[model samples]
Target: MSDAIVVIPTYNEIENIEAIIDAVFAQEKAFHVLVVDDNSPDGTHQKVIELQEKYPERLFLEVREAKTGLGTAYIHGFRWVLARDYEYIFEMDADFSHNPEDLVRLLAACQEDGFDVAIGSRYVKGVNVVNWPMNRVLMSYFASKYVRFITGIPIHDTTAGFICYRRKVLETIGLETIRFVGYAFQIELKFKAWKLGFKIKEVSVIFTDRTKGKSKMDSSIFSEAVFGIIKMKIRSMFTKTKPHA
Candidate 1:
């Protein structure tokens, strides 16, 4: 098994699952993949099982009974990887939005550069997103700005789903106490990591909106992120001790 593993959370991503897996493995670096599927009716998990025959050791799957939320799925994945021997853990979309080629750079940031967390950021170098509506681009750009102003975290892309984390960062941050279930989940993890004094670096990457399958994003996810930051900031003020592994 490789020292690094990418955790992809999927609902109904059959259209892109096979190609994405191939792209990740095609990289020069060898990285294992764990698919946390939400029992997609489209037989997404079944496809993973079939492909597991091809990449028996490098690819794995976990099928949940029902579709919960995105946060819970990742939290589950975190716990799974933490129990194993993997050193570098990643969060990526199964869709092609987060390029597989960038995974190598993200790993380099944490492994060779000694950063604790590496974010595949879309805003660190300006607005590098493609195929998104103007309204959405504006909303996403300003949302990161709002998160920075409110939480005092210096990250440019606060809600970015593409990320690489050193194992210790996950162990330091209290994963079970993570509350938000949508985009806010991404913010909370980064905020807690920063609060615990983990070094974070953002690698500039272009986010191409997915062409296949429907988007999981909705207004409720955005709304939660907007309001959740305030409550998270307030709670942090009272907590004095850093979370233990």
Candidate 2:
């Protein structure tokens, strides 16, 4: 198996499952995929099962009981892939919002450029998002800024889901301690990595809102990311910070 594995979490993403798997495989780099499907009612896992028949070794599946949070799905993927000898682990969406071509760049950031975490950031260069409403654009942009101000994490797109982690970073982060099941989970992971002095680099990429599948974002999840971050920050102040591995 290749050292790089892209872990994609799916929840009712049937519309985009097959196409996404195909796209990832089409890339020049030989990256394996681990789909942590939440048993999508629409048979997202079944589609992956069908595709796995053709590329059995490269494509892997982890069917979950029911719809769980995105954070937990990724955590499951992390543990599964970590058991193996893969050096680079990636977190990507089933939808087409994050371009598959950028996976090479993310890998390069870690393997070639010597960074611990590489983020396919939307705001790293500027607001390079398309098809999102103006309000949504502002909210997302400001949310990153808010997270930076409160948590003191130096990232342009704090809520970006498209990310790559070196094996050592995940091994050190104590995956069991990860909290927050919503978008805040993204921020928390980055924060913990930064606290431990992991080198993180942001690669500017345009985010095109998915046209096929429904969005997973909800008000409750959004609230957790917005207000919950302050609580996370306060807790961190009292707790002694751990050094990097």
lDDT of 1 by residue, 1-245 (tens): 79999999999999999999999999999999999999999999999999999998999899999888999999989999999999999999999999999999999999999999999999999899999999999999999999999989999999999999999999888798899988789999999999898899999999999999999989999899999899999999998956443
* Location of the lowest summed lDDT over 10 successive residues in candidate 2: 236-245
lDDT (C-alpha, whole model) for all candidates: 0.94, 0.93
Candidate 2 regions off by >4 Å? none
Candidate 1 pairs with clashing backbones: none
TM-scores for all candidates: the values are 0.98, 0.98
Best-performing candidate as measured by lDDT: 1
Segments of candidate 1 deviating more than 4 angstroms: 243-245
lDDT of 2 by residue, 5-59 (tens): 9999999899999999999999999999999999989999999999999888999
> Per model, how many backbone clashes are there?
0, 0
- The alpha-carbon RMSD values of the candidates against the true structure, listed in the order shown, are 1.2, 0.8
